[model samples]
Target: MKTNHPGPLVGILSARKADGSIAGNGPLFIALQKKLISLDGKSFVFIPEDAGIDHIMGYTFLPEQNHWKKEKFRYPDIVYNRVPFRKSEQSEQCQQFFTILNEKNIPYFNPCFIDKFELYELFKRHSFLKTFLPETILIEGKKDLFLFQKEHKSIYLKPTQSSKGKGILRLRLTDAAELQLDGIHQHELFKSFDHFWEKYGVELLTKNYLAQVEIKSAKYKGNRFDFRILAHGEDKGYTVTGVGIRQSQTQDITTHIPSGGRLLPYEILQTNEHDNFIEAIVPEIGMALSDRYGYFGEFSIDAGVSMTGHHYIYEVNSKPMRFDEEEIEEKKMEQLCRIFLQLSDYEN
Candidate 1:
C-alpha cells in the first residue's frame, strides 16, 4: 500500500439540531477529525459541506448561500467517510456528495452505497452468525407473527431501522419481562396468546418489524450482561480492540446504556472462574463475521457468554462506537488515524 505522506483530507458528517448544536453522533465525529489532524500535521482536512454527504478528504464548495464556510477548499486524496449511522434530519439534503466522492475514486471507509438489508442478510445467512442470532423472522404483518409463534415459544419484536435499541419488546407467555401499557409499568404476566396481543397489538400494527427468537443471556442481578466487543480490521482479519460488558438496571430487559444500563470492564466479568474461557474465546469471535461477511475494518461486535461457558456472537457493526476507554490514549488514537490513512492507500 502506498503511504499518504501527509494524511488524506478528512471530513466529519453529522447532524446538528435546529438550534445548531451537534446531534447524537457529533462528538465522536469531531474526535476522529481531531485525531487525524494531530497524527499528520496538516495531512487530514475535513471538508465543510452540508451533513448530507461527508468525506474526510479534499472538497471544493459550489458557492451556495448559507454555506457558513469554515475553511478553504481542498480536494480529498483520501476520505474517512464516517457518515452518520442513519440518514438523519440534518443530513437529509447531503446525500449526493458521498456519491461524488466515490465516483471520483476517493477511498472511503465504507463504499458510498449500501443496501440497508445487504449486511443484515449476510449476517443471517452466514453459518457462524446463526448461533448468536436469535431466530430472526421478518415480520411482514400479523400473519407472520402467528406463523412464528406456532413454531417458537418466545420472540423479541424489534424495529429494523430503529437504533439505541428503541421500540423493542419481548413477547412470551410468562411473568418474566414486564413493560408499560397505557403508561403503566407493571410485572404483568401473559397467560395466553390472546392476552399477549391484547396489550401490544397496536404496536405490532406498525409496518416494519423484525422478530428474533429469544435466547437466555447471562444474567446479573436479575438483569442481563452482554459484551460490546470493539474491533477494527484490515485485509488480514477482525482484531479485538476491547471488550466491555453492559449491565442493565435490575429487571430491565434491554442492556442499552441510555436505558438505565452501565458499561463494565472485562475484569468485573471474568472474576477468576471465567479467566481461561475469556483468554481462549473472546479474541476469536470476530473472525467468523470477517470470514463470512467480508467486513474490512472498524467494527463493534456485540457478543455474549452464558455462565454455562457458552459463547455466541449477537451482531457485527461495520461502523463501531467511539471506544475511548481510559486505558486508550492519545497515542492509540494517533495509531488508529495512521492506520486509517494506510488502509485508504490499500483500498484505493
Candidate 2:
C-alpha cells in the first residue's frame, strides 16, 4: 500500500570535488532537485566520498534564500545515480557506499553502469531483442579483427565501457584491401591489413572493445542520423519521455550530441513509418531491459533506422543525457520522481 506521507525522499548520487562541492552536471542536479519538489518529492545531492555508515553529507539548494545549504540526511528512499565517470563510480568509497545501501535494503534505480559489450550479449540472448541488434563481436585479438574485416568491409570498434563517443573508430576496407581508420579528430590509412594491425593491433588487443558490423544508418543532408529516445519505468511499465534525432556534424562513428552532433526534431528526420517503428520498439526495449536488470528508472536508447526502413538499436544508456531546454529536463526529472514515488508506494 501507498504510504501516508507528503513525499518520498530521493537522493541524487554523484562524486564530489575536493572542496566538497558536487561534481558532474551541477546545473542539471539543481534543476532536478527543484523539479522533484514540485512533484511533491524531496531531493538532496549525496556525495559518496562524504557518506558514512550512519548518514551522508547531503547538499540542498534553497531557491527562496538564493543560497545553498548542507544537511545530514540519514538516507533516501531511492538513489538516482548520476555519477559521470566510470573511474569515480568504481572508486573505493563509491563501492562501499553502494554496498552499505544494499545491506540496509535501500533501493536504487538504474543500479549500475551498463557496459556496451555486456548489454549486447544480454540482448543477444533473447531472440526478440537479437533482431534489433547489429552483428557485434568481442575483439579479443587480431584474429577476431581479421575475421570481422573479411566479412564486413566496414566496421566500428568501440570501447566496451565508454560514453560520449570517446575512443570510437570507424574502419573500412577498399576493393584493393587497403584499410582506413577514421577518428573523431583525424583519419589514417594503411597499405594493407598486416600493416594496419602491426602498428595499432597491440594497443587495441590490450583494451576491451567491441567490433560491430556498421549499420547503413539513415542520413540527413549526407550526414548520418539516429534517434535518442529516453524512457522511464514504473511497476506497471515504461514510458518514452522524449524522442529526438542526433545528426553528426562530421562523418564520425557515433552520433552522440556532445561529440559535435546536433539535435533535430523527430518529424524533420523521420517518416511516419520510422516514427511508428521507433514508438513501438522504444517501450519494448525499455521493458525488456528493466525486467533483465531487475529495477531501472530510465534508459536512453540510441536506435538507427536504415534508409530501407530496418530499425537497429545501437545502445541503451542507463545514465542518459538530458536535453538542453529547461522544460524538457524538468519533465524528465518529474518522470523520475514519479517513478521513485511509485516504487516507494509499492515497497511500503
By TM-score, who's the top model here?
2
Model 2 scores worst on lDDT over the 10 consecutive residues at: 339-348
Span of ten consecutive residues with least summed lDDT in model 1: 59-68
Q: What is the C-alpha lDDT of each candidate?
A: 0.54, 0.79
lDDT of each residue in 254-285, candidate 2, tens digit only: 78777788878876865687767767776677
Error of 1 at 54 (Å): 14
Best by lDDT: 2
